[model samples]
Target: MTAGNNGTNPPEGDDPFGYLYRSENGAPSAQGQQANSPRRSYNEVRAVGDRRYGQQQRPQPDQSPSPYYAAPETQPGGGQGGSGGPGRRAAGRANQEPARRNGLLIGALAVVGAVILGVGAAFAFSDSDDDKAGADPGASESADAGQDDAPDPDDGPPEEDEERPLPQENGSSLRLENGPVVAGDVEGSRAKDGSYIHGFKEGSAALWQPEIEEDGEYTVFVGYTVPGKDMSLQVSANDASPYSARFSNYAGAEEGDWAKGWTQTFAWVELKKGTNDIRIACGDKAEQCSVAMDRIWLEKGHVKK
Candidate 1:
């Protein structure tokens, strides 16, 4: 057998362990330097590290990109780069001037538009006033003439009422008996000038009775607002006795003053001289009105209408 057939020892000048670990570029290391040529050993090829290697290390190329491998930096203003100085700020202001002027111009236009609108409105108002003044000379006079009367403004705007003569004082008087059915409104009505009783709800009224010493024929005047076209009062004297007497409104009373009227609405009835009750019911009509009497005059003789 030949020596090549047995693999007991390595080839001439070769190391079986050193074949695994070698240095790159065959550079001299820091350890095991020669005396004459200053030779270095493989242990000092690189810096020592904290390593735990079960297998032998093999040589490999460096893969990191540290500063040692980077290219040198070039100065600016040589290629695509420019000198970034105060000129950049000047260019920015030059680009913004048009926008600033546009803003100022828009503000001035708005102020001018507002002034024009105010002047137009004032002129329009003045023209309309002039036209109205020239149109009707007696417009105010006509409005006053349309009224039922032109009473002194001091007398508190003549009451809203039908045209009627003013009130006159009554001649004779009687012991006025305030009725029991008098509610608070009736007292309030009594408080009103020329208004005695007030019946605010339907089917309600103020009652009254007079003691007559000697009764033959009497004149009665009722004061109240204008009666409805067909509004009739349901009244009775002494136990609901049928007394269908047509009572006329005390003229201006219907005109709305305390509704006091001096007109006569009388009836001829013979009495035995006792409690002659008078119930003037305004309830059959609207709560507003039917009949009210501020004063009553029962004279000696039968008075005509």
Candidate 2:
């Protein structure tokens, strides 16, 4: 009914928690208890965390004041005249240690990241340099130094691949056999003497001995004239198996006009680097033998050139 107990005992169960309210009946407050009061005996008016609970009370050593709940200005020598007590200093140091560790960790991570970036930048620069070198014309030339030189645009296109220079032979150099004759009657001969081998037919042959520079495949070209019809002859080299060498009617000349019927045809052959003998004969297998031979030559590959 009142704010305080007026220094008197309260009624039983009147308010066991009455001390929590304003005490208008004048009972001393929980904070106003003196050193010898009954409230001080039970330590009820002490700070919340001042004593340990659920433990036996024993003689305790004197220790520094707690930093918790203590004001910086109220601790011994903590005012403007002093920095702080040892307790405040210790708590300040403890609080700052985690921040210092975090700062150090962040700085280390930044340094590591910078190193990684530097390495990556170095690799990128190296790759860029390689690419630039690859695109450089001088570098390309050096890389291809062991290969064949490229054709110069001003010098004209590169010549086709040939192992050796072609060799030419005149019809007069051939040894006529079996009704063949070397005469000047046909006027379209490319020989120096304007002569050609003629009258070659079935069972006839013209053999020539020519020199070769290399051992490989070659093309044998025959310059001849046909009277308006396709003709062929049997050819053999080194006494090997004979094969047919066809000569087409490329001149379009009428019958009996050998001057207008001069043309060339070719066949592939194999020869070694030395003297080789070639024979053109109208053998039994020949499709036609009515062709006048004027020249025979060799090219350096399997295809006509």
Candidate 3:
């Protein structure tokens, strides 16, 4: 028999014992022996199988266009959307942000500097105030010195006593009698002539031994009384010149009868200390008037500067 006869093809009835071959239809069958067949890798087999079975491979995430991706809409400029638009605007704002931040920082620094300056100025002013608040020792010392040198109001020298008229022997010193009449047992009578008129009907008239060596302001006080009339007292020095105003007397009215005494005072009378005639009178009517004279006191002193 030849290589392939019925018997040699023999057991074609049962499937090959060791290995089985499947057709493209996945049916197990024994067929003609393949010779010099092209070998396929696993990936190539998968590709061919996918092509033959009309199956599609899913696209890789990285390889496919994303569903979220949007086509860029843009202006004519190639900047952002398609090329240049909003991207350029955002880039410009980003560039300017640093400048703005720098400006803010600089402004903050300026404010801090101003605050420091203000604090320094306040400290300087406070120092000046503190200086002013302290008392000046030099000024206090000067005031103390001045006070030490100043005169004491209460402990000063006593005022000098005024010189008084001297009492003399003889009636040459005329005594004031009733009214303007000068009457003394030793001295001759002298007339007042109403030279010094006061409001009284009675006054005093006297003559003093003048001492020209003692030239000073003299004050003479004559006290007297009159009856029934409002009276004032007056005195005159030297000759009785009607125009000579070296006379002074009490200012207001007098009280009491001639028997009762009324007293008055005369102010300053410029006089020489030599023999000078002094007359006292009443300011009543000359026709019928009289005054009772009392004591005559004289004082000599310097004029106030």
Candidate 4:
């Protein structure tokens, strides 16, 4: 205080500015202290710079953007960053969750539908096989039923209004002819020339065998021609007792024109299973006995046992 402090001075108490000084001499003033102070290190200066500029020292190129500083805002649930708006993250999750769920549901439905279709196809194939397996038996049963219901084929010949004669050949023996034979041993018999006869026989007879297992009705037809003679013919089987009838009355041939054709109708006869002989005899010993017999034929009828 005497002549005005010149170079340095000391504070009165422990001064707040003491941290900036060294105790090398009396307390230096502001300008003198600055000249004597040590220089700051590069690291220290860089740290201070970083703090002031809000930057890091040598930040890596690959470093992620800071959540608080990069872009507009960050998602609340830690997804892609977006505008700093309310419910941004929630809205993102809401949009994506339904798609994921829908995908999952679709996948599940596809699997379920595939299983259902597979099961249905298996069932259909099984049903088809079952139907195929059963069809054979059904068809066989139907065939058997049809066979049982069908009519027997052993029925007799059909009926006709007019009786027809069977044609005879040279091989047929035991033929009956009218009197006055054309060129046989009996040509000059008691009958007139070319007249009819009564008891006529042939040189050969036809053989017949019956089916005994299936007994049935049979009809025998005998064809004859007569001339002006009302005659009756009798037929006997195996030389048994004869059954006689006047064919003139039955065939409506009684008009006395005997040269016309005549037919003898007989009842249905049952045949046995052996050889049989059929014999014909004339009924009347009348005038000019002359007749011609053609042939005999057998026919089977219904009513089989």
lDDT (10s digit) by residue, model 2, range 1-305: 34455545442223334344435776745433321233323334766565642232533566555577657776666653234667667777889999999999999999999999999999999889889898575896786884656666799877668655567889888898888888888788888889888777678898877787668888889899988788888888886788788877888898767789899998787888899988888977444888888889988778865
Query: What TM-score should be assigned to candidate 1?
Result: 0.30
lDDT of 1 by residue, 83-186 (tens): 45445456657789999999999999999999999999999998898787765878767877878466777888655456333222211122222331222223
Candidate scoring better on lDDT of 3 and 4: 4
Model 2: lDDT equals 0.75
List, in order, the clash count of every candidate structure. Answer: 2, 6, 20, 17
Candidate 1: Cα lDDT at 285: 46
Q: What tens-digit string does per-residue lDDT give for candidate 3 at 1-305?
A: 23435463322222222123556675544442321223334344453223321134545556744345424442244355433557777877899999999999999999999999999999999888768755464766787899998778887875458744353222223554553433332111221331222222433334444454476676665444445454333456775442121222232333433333344445456777567766655433442334444445565553321
- Candidate 2, run of 10 with poorest lDDT: 32-41
Report the C-alpha displacement of residue 283, candidate 3, in angstroms: 7.1
Better of 2 and 4 by lDDT: 2
Tens digit of lDDT per residue, candidate 4, span 169-243? 221234443432333232322222333223433322223232332334555565455544555555566545766
RMSD of model 3, in Å? 17.1
Model 2, TM vs. native: 0.45
Return the top candidate by lDDT. 2
**Which residue pairs does candidate 2 place in steric collision?**
3-23, 3-24, 4-23, 4-24, 4-25, 6-25
Off by over 4 Å in 1: 1-195, 227-231, 247-264, 283-289, 300-302
- Model 3 regions lying over 4 Å from their true place: 1-206, 210-213, 232-234, 239-256, 281-284, 287-289, 302-305
